[model samples]
Target: MTLAWLCLMWVFLSATVATLPLRIQFIPGAILLVAGPVLIIVIGLQVGFVFSVIALAAYVSMFRNPLLFLLARLRGRKIEVPR
Candidate 1:
């Protein structure tokens, strides 16, 4: 029950962030990006690996662009952000 609520809240927050300007979305989006994996781990512990994997795939799809940008930075590649 608690996990379900948290997942719902996460989805709601993500949708809200999507509506904001790109620059403004970064802070909250970044927080969510960090929180997501932790939440997945907890969910795995509570539920099971299969559900956690599904959640991870969904999360990756949802945050693909931000994840890609972070990956580029980690790899020492320059990524241009659109203004």
Candidate 2:
């Protein structure tokens, strides 16, 4: 289905962004980060909860470092971003 293709494209894009330098990746990475949840929601509605959960797990693992950085900032921990 179309949704499956979209998910595949998202995975490919995420992998491509992962290979870029951290600084260079910030923009596209953030975009993907935001889009991920929306994509998962759509998947859940179209397919099923199990597939969406799997996608979410993959998303979390892929963006683990960025997610952690955001968590630290939220907790008021003075974590420095690597240059």
Candidate 3:
């Protein structure tokens, strides 16, 4: 299913980002953090809660990077990672 592919890709991207050296790792993490919510919003609109949850988890993991966290905090929003 499309949702399954999305989840798989999310895992792959996360893993690939994590394996990269520090200088490059941030790029993929930033991509995941920014792009994930958009993907979630798109899929969540048509699919269901399951895909949204997966996307949210990936987004959180991406944003968990300290640099990303500080950016999010600067904007003054709660760093939500589901329940």
Which candidate's lDDT is highest? 1
Candidate whose TM-score is highest: 1
Candidate 1 lDDT score at position 18? 96
Model 1, position 65, has a per-residue lDDT of 94
- What lDDT is obtained when candidate 3 is compared to the true structure? 0.73
Q: Write model 1 residue lDDT over 1-83, tens digit each, in one string.
A: 99989988998999999999988998999999998998899889999999999999999999999999999999999999987
In model 1, the worst 10-residue window by lDDT is: 22-31
Question: What's the TM-score of each model vs. the native?
Answer: 0.95, 0.93, 0.60
> What are the clashing pairs of model 1?
none
- Predicted candidate 2 versus true structure: per-residue lDDT over 1-83, tens digit per residue: 99888888989999999899989999999999999999999999998999999989988998899999999999999997889
Instruction: Tell me the number of clashing residue pairs for each predicted model.
Output: 0, 0, 0
Candidate 2: list runs displaced more than 4 Å.
Answer: none
Candidate 3 deviation (Cα RMSD): 6.9
Q: What local distance difference test score does each model get?
A: 0.94, 0.92, 0.73
Better of 2 and 3 by lDDT: 2
Alpha-carbon deviation at 79 in model 2, angstroms: 1.0
Candidate 1 overall lDDT versus native:
0.94
- Give the per-residue Cα lDDT of candidate 3 at 14: 73
